[model samples]
Each structure stands twice: as C-alpha cells, then as structure tokens.
Target: MSKTNLDIQLKTIPESAGVYQYYDKEGNIIYVGKAKNLKKRVSSYFTKTHDSGKTRVLVKRIADIKFIVVETETDALLLENNLIKKHKPRYNVLLKDDKSYPWICIKKERFPRVFPTRRLIKDGSEYFGPYTSMKTVHTLLDLIKGLYQLRTCNYDLAEDKIEDGKYKVCLEYHLGNCQGPCEGYQTEEDYQENIKAIREIIKGNFKDSLGQFKQQMKDYAEKMQFEDAQRIKEKIEVLENYQAKSTIINPRISNVDVFSIVSDESFGYINFLQISYGSIIRSHTLEIKKKLDETDKELLELAIVEIRERFNSKSKEIYVPFKVNIGEEIKVTVPQLGDKKHILDLSLRNAKYYRMERFKQIKITDPDRHANRIMAQMKADLRLSEEPRHIECFDNSNIQGTNPVAACVVFKNGKPSKKDYRHFNIKTVEGPDDFASMEEVVFRRYKRLLEEEQPLPQLIIIDGGKGQLSSALKSLDLLGLRGKIAIIGIAKRLEELFYPNDPIPLYLDKKSETLKIIQQLRNEAHRFGIEHHRNRRSKNALNSALDTIPGIGEKTIVELLKKFKSTKRIANAKLDELEEVVGVSRASKIYNHYHKE
Candidate 1:
C-alpha cells in the first residue's frame, strides 16, 4: 500500500460502472460502494476534501481497494449491496434485526397438529408463514379453532392402537375442542375434511372452505336443528371476517414476493412482503447501515434475495420498484398502476415508516441536529433552493367533456393540510381540453390567493407532463410569479419529473421520500378532483331529468326531489306521493309522462 503502488492501481482502474471494496491494514473490508465510473469515483476520495469526519477517516484507513466491473450501473449497485450485507463491514450500515420470525407449521402426522414454531425442520410439514407478528399467528389459530374440532393430545393416533381402545376421552374432548379421534369416536375420513379446510385457510384460499361451511349450515337448517344451524352460521361469519381482514389486494396476484427499499447516505431500510392469494401473510422491514454510498436498486435487490431465502419463498415473480439484476430464474416486474403498483407502494411505505421511526428514536437524543439533517436532506433530495415546507399539487378531471373540474391539495410540513384544499369548476375551458383546463385552474387558484394575500406554496406539482406544465407556466408568467415558486410536472406514466426549459425529464429514486410525497400529492389531487366532478355530474343528472318534466317548475322539482330523494324514486312514486310533494296538476303531469313511457 505505498503511494506509488496506489497511483499505479488508480491508473489501472477502468472508467466503468462496478462495485468497489476498501480493505484496511488488517485485511478486513471496511467499506463497500458502487459507482458509475470507478476510476473517477475512487480517485476523488484521495484528491478531494471531505467535510465529514467519517469520510476523512475512511479515506485514511483504506490500505487497499478492489473493484469488480459490471455491465450496467444497476448491476454495480446490486453487487455492492449484496457484498456489504454479507460482509457486514464495520463502516457499512447493517440490518438490525436480532429476533427470528414465527412460522405456523402443520405437522404431517396422523390427525395433524397445527401450531406456531420458530424452527424449520424438513419433516414434510407444511409451513404457512414466518409471520412478522405473533398476534397475527394467534389470530389465525383462534379463527381456525372456532371453525373446527382439533385434538390437543400428543398420543399417537395409529389405527391399530385406536382400534385396541387404549386411550380414553380427554378433557379437550369433553370440552368439545376435540372429536375424540383417539377413542374412535370420530372417523378419520371426517376429521381429514376439517384438516383439508384448515389447509385451505392457511394458504389464504377461503372459497372452498366457505362453500363447505355454507352447505353444512344449510343441512342443519333443513333438518330443523335451529341451534345447530345458528352455530354453523356463526362459524361461517367468523371465517368470512378473517378472510376480509387478511385479503389486501387482488386475489389473482397470488404467490409473489414484494420488495422495496428506502435508503439515505448512512443507512437503508428494506421491507419484504410475502403475498399468497393476494393477502400479505408475512411482512418485515430490515434496517441496513450503509458502509458507503449504495444505490436503492442495489440495496433492494440484495434485500430481496436475502429475505426470500430466509422466508423460504418459492415465488417465481417479484414486484420491485425498478429493474435490477437479480437473476434469470425470477421475473422482475416494476408495476406502474393498478393493484400491483398499490402493493409496491404499500411495501415502500412500510420501509419509509420504519426509517422514520428509527430517525425519531435517534432524534429524541439530539433533536436540533436531527431536524437540521432532515431539512438539509429534503433540500438536496428535491433539488430545491429551500426546504419545501409548503407544497401544493393541481389535478384536472373530466368525463367525456362533461363536468370538468380541478382540485388543489395542499401539504404543510410533509402532511396533508385538508383545510387548505380547494376545488374549481372549469369555467373558461370548454370540452375536455386538459391543457386549457390546467391553465384556467392554475390561474384562478393562484390569482385569488395572490389577491387575498394568502401564503404561496414553496413547491407546485402539476399532475402531468410537458403540456400541462407549459399550460401552468403560462399562468405563472402572466401573474408575474413564474420564478417565485419551484414547480415541476410529474407524468402519470413512468413518473418522470419535468422541469421548465429542460427537455429531458429527471427520474428520482423510486424509494425516495421526496418522490413518494410527490406521488401522494398527485393521487390526492386526482382523488379530490374526481370526487368533485362526480358530485357535480350527479347533481346535474338529477336536476336535468326532473327539469324535463312538463308543469314542473324549479320549486316543484325541488319539492319532489326533497321528498323522493332521486329522479328514479320520483319516477317510481305513486300519483298520491307525487301530489304530496308537488302540486296536483304537476303531479298528474309527471305521472302521465312516466306512465306513458
């Protein structure tokens, strides 16, 4: 590790994307990093001045550097994350979990027993989950207990022993928890039916068991056994309740692994979600300390492999936030919309929350420093001149050129400020002209705020690409507020962030809190705008139908609607009911118009 040898090593370093490892004098890896250009990145450590004490110490301690060239930046990122996690370098951030997860195991014995276990033994037993919470495990067990009679004994239920009648009915059998299969009181075939149902429940497939329960309930009801039928009905209700709570996404998205990561300069938080029949059976977040700067793609890919291995996941497909080089054996999907995107967002949210909680715990010890760090990170991550303490997003909604509306959702200090939200009808824009509609809404929204002397947002997010952004820019220019606010447009497809006068869009890390908040603002604006549009359309549709009736004035229609609540109800109303609301003449005319149809 002489200076001359270091210089020669630097010269040999290729200008390529790859993972680099730094070793100390003791021959132990101290740090791992990924870079787009290895020669430039590694060279800068020695040539540049680092403000951070940790970086300076790291540079001084680096006795040797080793790098592996990769085909792409993503490959470099994945390799770096994997190597750091495996080596657990002293300078690297490590995942801080010390507790093993609990799994529900169904023993493969005669009259099988189902219970929670931490150890995985290869004894042909079916394992359901390495559940993140023991409470969830107990809840599922209780639900199953309520639905079936299971034995609570360890006695072998061999057929010959059971025929010899060596065992007596136990307390569990007397309490109705077991069917006394050991004493031959219950047939094995019958008990196996319940086991089959329990297997389906464990797999998160409730349809088959629910059908069987319904059929049993009907059989009891037909046999004039009211109490038995009620008991069976309760079991059905319990199963349905459990199913409703467990299912979180589209049932078609079965047997898949979901991985998302949120990382900063010092650490990375990776969340893993195991989905079965669209229900999340297991979820956990691992907090990894960064040895050096690692890309989110790299951290997430490493986490996915490690988590899947730990959970014994055999899923062929995985949902990730972006494309990375995991392997050819698994299909990686970056969902853009619908249930897949929602589940991916859910996983990312879990990781983000875990990171926030960890930060909050640290902030308790050093509040001021933590606050300053957060503000600085926010400013840098969003590429903003100042901290985005106040933000607003605008969205336009219309249906086939009808009831065009816009909504503005406000956020203060990264949380939704519901009171400040505003809705606008597209007064100036005709048809479904989204660009013009965006212009009118932006102008009216800010123009009124400006005239009223209300505070303006530090950031403005237009929920569209170049067209909507340009339209909004026109408003800002006309109002002389173009340069005052930092505004950007986020396209729905690919989520590309567009800047003014910049043709190329900026793609932020998918797991970054800044991008997540922007997405939240956009979704909220769209939801608010669509709600307003729906309300306006419903009111118009209600009034239009009644307004077309002969002899029905505004006052008469209002009276009719106030009594009937809807035009459909009015149409279905008897002559007398209509006369009770409107006048007799209008009522008769309305009745005739409806009856004539």
Candidate 2:
C-alpha cells in the first residue's frame, strides 16, 4: 500500500472505465473497487501521501492489479459489489454477515394476523417490510396485531371450532386483542378492515386511525361485551402511544421520501426516510457494497438515485443530502439544524442499524454460482455450447401494468454486476400484459446491444413461464440476435424452469443453492424496477401538486421545497418559518394561500 508504488501504478494506468482489485502478495484480494477512470481513482491511493503509514503498509504489499473496463460508473458499481461479495476481500471494512433485515411477519389465516419474524418463507402470507430495526420490527408487530385484533394463532381453528361457552377465548381474545373470528365473534370483512387499519397506521395516520379504533371500542363496550371493549381499548392505547411519539415530529407532509449516503473504502450505506400524511413514519437503510471509489458527495448523489429507484414518485417527495441530477424541482439540501435535522438523524440511525443487521454478513455463496450452474445446466439440459459467463435476468413491474418498466440485472462469475444493471420503461405495451412487456424489454435491450460494441451476454432470463420466454425470443429473433444469448424462463411456485424451445419444468426440486440464486436475480430485478416506477410516480404526483399552487413559479417551488421538507409541511409552517426559507416572497403570497394557519 505504499504511496510511491501506487503512484507508479497510477502512472501506468490508462484513463478508462474498469473494475480494479487491490491484492496482497499472497494474491489475496485486500479490496475490490470499480472506477469510471481506473488510473485516476486507483492511483489516488498511491499519490496522496498520508500522515500515518497504515495505507502505505497495505499498498507496499500490493503484488498485482486486476481490471476490466466498463461503459459506465453504474456498471463499475455492479462489478465491484459482485466481486466484493464473492471474494470477501480482507482490506474492505466489510459489512460481513448481514442480508435482508428482520421484517414483521403477519401470518394469513382465517383470523389474519401479524407477527415479527426474521425468516421470509414463500408461504401464502404477505410481508410488509425489509425493515432495518429489530426493535422497530417488534414494536410494529405488537402495534399492528395488538391494536387491530388480528389473530396470531398457529392453529387451524375453524368458524365452528370455538363457541363462546364451549371454549374460553384465548388470552389475546379475552384481552380484546384477537378479533375472535375463530368463534364467529367477527366476520372476515371485519378482520380485513383491521388489515387496512394496520396499513394506515404504518402510513403515519395513527391519530386518525386511533379515533376510528376508539369508536370500535365504544361499540363493543355499548354492546355490553366488556371483554371485547377492553381489547379494543388496549389497541387504542397502542395507537395513542405511537401518536404521542409522532408529536415529536411536526406535521406538514403529503407523501415523500428522503435519502442520504455515506461511504468508506470498501462499503457504503444509504439511508431511506419515508414520510406520509404528516409524520416521520418509517425509514430504512440499504448497505450498498458496490461503488466506484465514491467521494462523500458521490455517495449523496447515489443516495437519491438508489432510493428513487426503490420508491414510487406519486407517493413521495424526495429530500436529498446534496444537489442531484434529478432534473426539475427535486429538493436537495445539507441540514444544519431544525426539523430537518430530526429527520436526518433518524435516517442516519437507520443506516447504522442496517450496517449492523444487514450489511455486516459475509455471503458464503458467490452469487455467480447460480449463473455458472444455470449455464452448465443449460449445457446439460438444453445442449448449449458452453457455460454462460454473462447471465441476464429481466422482470417487469407496475400496478395494473401502468408505468410498466423492466429491469435487467447482469451476472458474471456467480455474482451480480450492479454497474451493468439496466432498466427499460415498457414503451410499446399497454395494460397488464406480461408477455408484451417482456417483448418490449427484450427488444429494447438487445437492440441497444446490437448498436453497442460491448461483449454480449451468453444467457437471458425472463421472469415468467413459456409465454414470457416466447415473447422475448420472438423479439430477439426479429432483431437477428438469436443464439447470441441463450434465453430461458423462470416461473415461481413449484419454481418451474423453461427454455425457449423446451417444455416448462415445474418445481423440479432445484437444490436450495440453485433456487437461492435464481430467486436473488428475480428479487433484484423486481426491486430495481419497482423502485424506479415508484420514485417516478411520487415525483409526478409532487409536480402535479406544485402546479396547483398559486403564484409559485418553478424556481419558487424548488426554493419552497428546499426550504421546507415537503410541500405539505410548508403549507403547515408559520409564515415566519416560511419566509425564512430561501427565496420566499416578501409579499407572502405563498404563505397566504398554502399555509393552513
């Protein structure tokens, strides 16, 4: 890690985009980083002489340098994350063991309940999170289940199984905690309504929802069902406690997302703060290990894009830690004090939690294993000529197929290259047709591939059954790009596998290792596509609201948002606070119309 040697390496390095490796003499990878300009970033380690000799020692041990040029920094990030995960380099301050953090698990039964658990099994149940805090997860589970009276039973109790006199209600039921659907004490509709209440509760409407819960408690009390009333009353109390916490954060929110990023040499963390209604409802952090030797500001920039990729724009107004290239009036700032500081602190705490809970774990299996094996399986099962070195997976996501977009994630050597990940907004298809959407994404992806002079992948994976695979293949054939990338289909549930010309293999008992890899690709694709759609959707919604405000020019809207966290908060703020915000009108036109006070 000597400065002189690093300078020498930088001197010989070409100013081109590529993946780079820092290796010790034993040829062990000390760190893996990607860069748009390898010579510039890599050589910085050597050229910048430091006070301490810590890096110098490691730099001296550098026996070799490895690199692969790529088209974009995004591709560089992808490759770096993949390499870091696969190799588990020594010099990287690795978030070693963490993966997806704990989420509150609600079992879907006749009673329909919510419980907190770390495991994500592909059962019939719905998962509401990839939450960062175990404490928050448990608190949320308790809040949702206790307040809603959603059952947490493990038994298959039928409607006729329990009679009020035949059996005493369980502790939860007697405490007015369970909805008591097991004894026909409540209908499915009532239980379902409870689920909606939980959703609204999580959305920061605890006070409003609390009022509604209290009415339910009153109804049960008036019916002379003191027991049920007591249960509902407890739920109201949980809601009240949460509401009290909300008071710590002032109101002025519609829907919005906030993000920040911090990085070191080998790993980085991005904090996501999600707000709705008027409260600081929830936040999350993504422990991103891949980057191109990101500077502090670069981390902040990626924070916006990363969170924006994950959230829909219609439901959110994003606040960033630094100015980003998000075009238009997206609010960006570096907080010094006030309510914004409170939110920023929350985001940072979440990032630390994720660093501990999710990012710290080392993945034993190289993600590239799936690609290597799937490629081998292709040779064995589909008679392919060779193992697929470059594996690509595509998936489309949108509600009612609106805002349809497809994500393409590239895998090389049993690992994902985030830098190589690409997204396609479904342009040609309308409505909820998966097949057509598949056709659109595939056609667009390969068309660009044909135009570009980069190496093409050997395999293509579509997130569907035969129909989707056929559509993609059709598009490829039309582009005269057949056989260039092997195409296959992966269907969920019985976890089926299908090749373009072969019959679908339903739930073939793929080994946990094999199943795990494909699932990762599909999940990443889903995550990437949905995030883009949501951020766009939320941004669009915010823009529409901005249009509705009077006497607020575009620059004024940006200034208002930059001044206040969200437009709704601006509307709710005192005139003095609004005026203090940068570029607010002295005439107070904005405060006059928007401020509720």
Candidate 3:
C-alpha cells in the first residue's frame, strides 16, 4: 500500500477495544497486538519512536493493516492470543512447546474405564489432565487403581445387556482387580459413587475419598471382615500419603494458577503452576524467545494466556509476582505474605531453575551463545557502554606488612585466561600501603601493555573499596585512559561494588550470575597474589642467611646451595666437598661463616 492509503486507513480505524494485525506486502501477518483503544494504539505505532531496532524494522515492513473490533478488552485479549498462536507472527515472542502431554481419561461407557492416553477425543468422556510427563500420569493412574475396584476391560455393562447375559467375568474380575460389572456383579449407583470419588481425587482433593475409605474400613471391621478392613485401611494410608506429598500450602487456596518469570536479554522463562485444594496438579515452564526486548510484564501476561489455553485451565484466579494488565475476567493477585507469597516465590524459583538448566545445556552445546549472553548480562548489570569481552581484575597481598605484591588476572569471555595472569612486586611502595601499591602496579601493568601495543581490557576490577578504586583511576588518568575503560572496586566486607565518581555502592544480588563472576575474578586475583607473595617471602628468608658472608655473592651462594641444598647442609659439608662446588677461597670463607654460626 502507498503512504496515502496507509494514512487513510489509520484515520478510519475505530476508537474501541480490538486486536490489530500488521501485514507485509505479500500478505503475511508479521505482528499481532491488542489495545483498549484501536485508533490510538495503532496510530502510536507509526507516530512514536521505538527503542528496539526490530520494532522499527517491523513498522517499516508493514504494507497493510487489519483489525477485529471487540466489545470488551477481555475479548480483545482473547482474540489477540488466538491469532498470535494461529499465525505465529514473525515479530512476536515465540511460544515453542511441541510435545503432546498425556491426560487421564475416564471412558464414556456403562462401566467406565480409567486409562492414560496422549490423544484426546471428544466422545463425551471426561479428561482430567494434560500432565507435564507420562510418568506423572502413570503414577496418578496407579494411585486410582489401588483405591478403586474399576474394570480394565472394554465391556458394555448396560442393564439390558447384563440381563440378557451377553458378557462374562474376565481375568480382571477373577484377580479381584474389578467388581465384575460386566456380569451384573456391581450396580450402576455404587459404580457412579466410586467414579465421583475418583473425579475428586484427580482434581487433587482427597478429603472426600479419605473419609469414604475410613468409613468403609470401620464398617468392615464392625462386621468382623478383618481382611477387607485391612485392605481399606491400606488404601486410606495411600491416599493420605499422596495428599501429604501434593499439599504444599494451606488447603483453602485451590483452583488457582500461579505464574512467575525470569528473563535474560534474549529469552524469557515463565513458570506456571496449577494448584487445586493446596496441591499442585500441574507445572510447566515456557521459554519465549524475545523479539523486541519485551518486558517481564508483557511476556508473563502473554504466557499466562497461552499456557492456560494449552493446559485447558478454567481457573478464575492467578497469583503473580507483580501487577499486570491481562484483562478483567481472571483475578490477578500480587501476593505479599504468608502461603500465597511462598507459592509465588516457588514459581519464581522454578523459572530461575529452568533458566539455569537451559544455560548449562546451552553452554555445552553452544558455547558462543552462552558467552554472548553472559557478556550482555555483565554489560547491563555493570552499566558499561559495551560488552566486557576481555576483563582484568587486580588484587594486592601484603599480610603482616611482608612481601607486598599484586596480581593481575585476565578473563576472556567470562572465563579465566591463566596465561595472561601477571604478578607484580611492590617496588615503589613501602610497607603494606594497599592504595599506593595498587596505583604503582596499575600504572606499570597498563604502561607496559600500551608500550607493547597489547589489547586493553574493556573492564577493570580493583579488589578493595573506594580508596583503592581512586588509586587505580589516578593511574588510568595518567595514561590518558581513564574514560576509555570501565573500572569498579569490590569491598570484601559487604561485597559492595564502588564505581569511580559514584558515592553510593551497588550491591548486586548474592546469587546473580554477574556477581558470581565478579566474585570469581576477585578470588582468583587474591589467590594468585598470595601465592606469589609466599614465594617472595620464602626466597627472602633463604637469602637472608646467605647474604651475611663478606666475600660470598649471589652466584657463589647459588653454587654452594646447588651442591649442599641448604644452609644447614653447607655448614656441615667438609672443605673438599665445598671446594668441589665453589672456588677454594670462597669455599673456605663459606665454611668458616657457617661453622662459626
């Protein structure tokens, strides 16, 4: 369409709640969105500037526009969700779940059979769940089978068919697995009652079932049927055990959906938990690939709609970590305390774990993508202008004011580059002055790197507080590289991050990946610096005893030590043994010095 035609269409759009679709020249739906007012929302897409480049590209590609007017915002939201799933627009977040989950079905027959199946048929039979895994379905089926004497065979147990004697008892009936409904052994009313209990159990409410089992057990015991009573008692125990495992919160919180999100730069993970009678009936985590740098609220809202539709949930209430504008039909709650908050936290944890598992998997299968994500995350978390692909961290070690030294550890793509690790002896600073020592080493390290034309790190980490950070900054300023590189200092007491010219320190979450990498760098530098310092202290101690001799130099001391291995051995060596390793005059002097000592 021409610009004129687009302008005309934009003007003609109705100002009401509706879903809008944008299409390219070839008539492919490229995006779908819902709004409370169609005219304003659709016009804003073209009138305002978009921060995301992809959104700009999407707007530029739009050659035609279409919309579906709805009476309410809820209808618009539903329509938008359906259209997005159906067309799967190129510019929208991709919801990619392709597995066929299993569901427990109660067969629509005279004697209904309960079984697990992957396929759902609309033949008037009731389906309980589209469970996350087949193992869960099998476990529930086993629990149901243990509790009820239901038939496994496909037999019509109609009143007329049983009266005409059309069917006989099968092996299931002989083995006591069924009540022999095919041969009129079980009445329809009694069978219906069992089915009702099973329905409640499948809904994650075992209260009625447990009560019925206990009553049955008591009746059997009163009649002196001890074997039947024992069996009933066992069933009651099984039900109670299952309920205990499933019930995680107060039993009053039932038939609700909980959603929480954890997102990175490229993707969002949304975890959905369906709770019934304080028991978790279903759990699923959806991974959505972000197209336009969508916010958590937007991704979560879309995911809640999609997951609810996919799972066939009719839940009227939902618990979320924050408020969202996902229509008015379903109650959206931001739980702040008690069991509700606990469950919300659990959902968030699930999302985080799912994201972590994906990262681990991606790191092994696609290391480049993993590195890119970490780099991007670090860049954002540290408020850097670009990704810190190559980072260097510095630490000083001067325990007890001895063997003052510093270490520089380099990290490339978030992993330590051990070969690039450098140790610096505190030549300019006296005693344990960490600030001056840090300044001298920082100046020397970068001065040499600049002189040799080596690539500089994008970020520098100083292992101390603001004083150390200021010292490092002075070195960078002297080299005219102060603003060229990003630098921060980490305080050990609180893990506080100090930035240059910033008074308030930034405290990242303890479990955040960015903080973990920062902590790793700090620790590596500390270990490297300490190791070098220890070696220096040991070497100085060894040389102190040997330096006292008037005529002996470093070369003579080295040669005598090479032969005698230590000062104690050199002192004990005979004149001829010392003379063989060193010259005669030096050997005599060294022997006299050690023997006199």
| Candidate achieving the largest TM-score | 3
**Per-candidate TM vs. native?**
0.58, 0.44, 0.94
Candidate 3: Cα lDDT at 437: 97
Instruction: Give the alpha carbon lDDT tens digit for every residue of 95-209 in model 1.
Output: 5433378888888899888889888899999888778888989988999998999987888999999999889998998898999999999998998898898988887888998
> Candidate 3's residue-wise lDDT over 307-376, tens digit each?
9888999999999999987778889999999999999999999999999999999999999999999999
Each model's backbone clash number: 5, 45, 0
The true-versus-predicted C-alpha distance at residue 403 of model 1, in Å, is 47
**2 versus 3: better TM-score goes to:** 3
Stretches of candidate 1 above 4 Å error? 3-21, 32-60, 65-86, 96-99, 263-266, 365-369, 378-597
lDDT of 2 at 12: 84
By TM-score: ranked, best first: 3, 1, 2
Model 2, 24-50: lDDT tens per residue? 768788877667789887777766885
Candidate 2 similarity to native, TM-score: 0.44
Q: Evaluated with lDDT, which candidate comes out highest?
A: 3
